[model samples]
Target: MTRKTLLILLVSMHMIFGPHSFAQQRTQKPPLHAKHWMAITGKPLAATAGAMIFQKGGNAVDAACAMIAATCTMWDTLGWGGETQALIYNPHTRKVVGINALGVAPTGATPEFFRSKGMKYPPEYGPLAAVTPGTPGGILVMLAEFGKLSLKDVLEPAIQMADGYPIEAETANLIEREKERLKQWPYSRQVMLPHLGEKREAPEPGEIFRQPDLAATLRKLVEAEQEALKQGKSRKEAIYAAYDRFYKGDIAREIVRSVQEQGGLFTLEDLARWRVYIEEPVKTDYKGIEVYKLTTWVQGPVMLQTLNILENFDLRAMGYNSARYIHTLYQAMNLAFADRDFYYGDPYFPPAEPVRGLLSKEYARERAKLINMERNDPNIKPGDPYPFQGERNPYLKLLEKWGEQQKGAAKSDSQESARSNEEFEKDFYAGTTSVIAADEEGWVVSVTPSGGWIPAVIAGRTGIGLSQRMQSFVLDEAENPFNVVAPGKRPRATLTPSLALRDGEPYLAFAVQGGDSQDQNLLQFFLNIVEFGMTVQEATEAANFNSFQMRSSFGNHESRPGRILLNEAIPSWVRAELRKMGYEMTFAARTSGPINAILFDRKHGTMWGGSSNHGEDYGIAW
Candidate 1:
């Protein structure tokens, strides 16, 4: 159908079925003949932007980049100054690529700096935790390397969206939740809150929200591209120039000035030297499907490890969301996370084992033996992931020393439950928005853009906010050598997004916005489709659970043992059985995911998409 005809048909449908009535029906039976592509995003407008890009003859990477930019605009918490990590599958090569756009700590940031201030850890909010912005670099690099569209073309939607957009109910609630923090800073208040004669208040839904300063910042990058173009640079070079402008030019200078002036750790050198690296993804095979995630720097490999361990059991036989199934899954995840706690860290650091060891089938088999279906394993410990048969391994001394250090550093068992409860109550949403796109050519991309929440102190007038990622670093330098704060080191992040391939073809692309619960949610979403035979929408809406027994990814890395939270939708009998089995149970108001997913069924030559309908998240298939 022509664009005009499609628009008319949509309008007519809305009129005939009533606004949103068609959407309800669409969820019940998602279209199987979306001719070109399908997309899901944290916001409806972002999905619309991706659809528009596809209509404009752009590819999946182009649509994904555009959707992410659009998401940053409508969801102010995740945009230019935030971090973006993506997993892209190129069908032609049948290979998946990973983007590590997560920011690194500045040279000026150190554990001693906070210690000198008489603190055990850095505050979760404000300048001390801020890292160099990574989204601009990630977006520009993706456009230059993998995309078919120019920077201007992909960024146009976000720039327009930044100028002004109607505030949705969820956005309004988010703003209200952060209003008190926003008021603490003048620039943040101006940008995020409603202005009424110099008094700031929470904005209502449907009110016009404007970010002229953010728009100007985005436009400035476009101007840099224009300048490079006029100077006879190719489109690709112009895109790089825009990146340079953000990191090495005026934008960097302003960020440095504001951050340093406000007593933060960021410097011009930090911005100038920062680079977003593209690396090989970590992969594992589960029931013939290959799952791909970004490397161990983030918590991506944990999913691979969890899947590997779960691969040993017949989850389908155990029954979906049954007590036995939940118990087995929880045990597997707990064991996997125990390894994650001790082994997962910056791969560049000392004693870092090859990522292959974490995903190895042999290692998974050994880890799977630790699970006990009848009872929860409260005293979990990391395993020897290294594959070796020698009587005495060379690294045994280091491992012993590491184990002793962790034992000394860890809090007593009696104090663990209280600390875990406090951590859960304080930090739930660790700042993220996700977007996924797929095209006719079978290219698929999943990007999780995060950070720059109101808790993150904004740089003055630059409309660029810093990331509080420094909190993810470890303060106990003696106990945690791999995750310690270091100059130019990327913190171990929780911003994991994933893509799956079936028989060497693109199958699914998905991600969620919760903090430590990301991998758990992704695993369930994957199973809900592949194991339960649910559509994308059904998979997303399926009941979800998370085991908070592992250490958090936020400040101080506090751990809680045997704490399992199940969605209210899970049967009451299952909860009762879990509690009887010694699992500390809590009924969550909702699941840990506002999961956004896209399923590409290459056999049927059809694409399916879904999003969390209860929130601002939306999806479009066409």
Candidate 2:
């Protein structure tokens, strides 16, 4: 056998014969490669689903759609009733596209509307936190534009799995943890915490956990497609029938009724008017590798911007995971994140901030110049991107208090305000799930589908739960115009996915599930490969750090100032050096998630895949 063939055979043998106890462990994984295709996801079942689709004559997009649907069904962190963002590279066209499916704020959801309710920020749970459903619409768009399978074909696995599948131990624990919260709503409790015998606790790890309601809901969409086909509609046209059923028909009506009855502002028009958009991706060349991300609407660009600044430094020379390397990494991230917090928003809206200027190499150099090597700086603010580009500033003040200028609704007691602030801080860190797939045809897709952490509220009997995406919006209208709650506006999302192209060919398709720590982790992952020359598994398994010094994208937008978080596995010497540099260091057992990635070496015509050992992340190359 050839050396590569022998390696694959040995790995397969080990997988089959090794102790099964370590199946749930991540640190034991070896780098796996295949000649044709690969898949990875937060859950093993999802990865299997994607591989099955690939074997059944599906392309990258088709496999991704199947994998996304399967992951949504199995993982509560990201369910079918949420939002998704994708970065796709079509090798045939040599074009990279950003598929943004972030739902819009309701037309009636205004600052005054919340002010009238005597609250500054929106509620974390209930109808007030929902936006129009986007996942179903996004699926249809992907199927129509790039997929080779019919809706029925791609969705069958997910629908069947939803009807009946064994719950993982980790997922069962999550259900138990959120049982009380899920019980707050009868519809949610019934759908999630179904009775198994006399008790209402979470099901055991290997027990079959079925969501008949969700299965029925998915079947209804499929039924719509079948009905359209019977009426002589084209396959594409039939797909739209399924889309209409979700957005413009009974599903939309059900969602609106549940929302409005609970004091929300959703209407049929808001649902009907919403549509997913496929736009060009924003990119920057890093060491001859072109990195791409979604524009300002989400935090994807933060990675691109940070990379631009780091490109100037010989990161390898600084030494991997060294105090100097780690310090420089955070300093670069702090600067990029500061700009992201101040300027990133929906580019479709008015008061244009410099998205282009922020990604410019010259701008990165200017921002990098501000970083000091001696001590950690906490007071760093947003820079003048427009000034660098020779344009006028969009706002009089870059940073504005969201509701400070607004009439303080009914002047609550100081204690009440303090409680409100504490509650806001508690709800910021939500959950997410991601998938990466590559096909023999050279099409690669990296998708981060999220928004189910607050699935405490169910939308009536549609078997479809809703999300708290509205919490992503800033109630303060003066902060960032692109992020303010407004009609037809996408909330500034922290769900970011990434794609890299080397020499104009698909190089890497990767994404992570760390709420606000996603971009920071991704920056480290990319460098671990490009700079440190680590294998895909080594890159993913390496210890990492995060700086909470900047404001988080989650609830309340709180900042930790100079606080830094590192893994306990990082060298103690590095940690001590960081402390010496004036950083308030905190240690965690581990930080990298559920990171799923696939890298293609076009020159050698081979693919390598890696999935983080943390949680249930799984990968397969064949």
Per-model TM against the reference = 0.90, 0.90
lDDT of 2 by residue, 234-283 (tens): 88888889999999998778878876765677889998998899999899
Residue 449's lDDT in candidate 1? 84
Q: Could you report the Cα RMSD, in angstroms, for every candidate shown?
A: 7.9, 7.0
Candidate 2 runs further than 4 Å off: 1-27, 196-200, 398-429
lDDT of each: 0.77, 0.78
Clashing pairs in 1: none
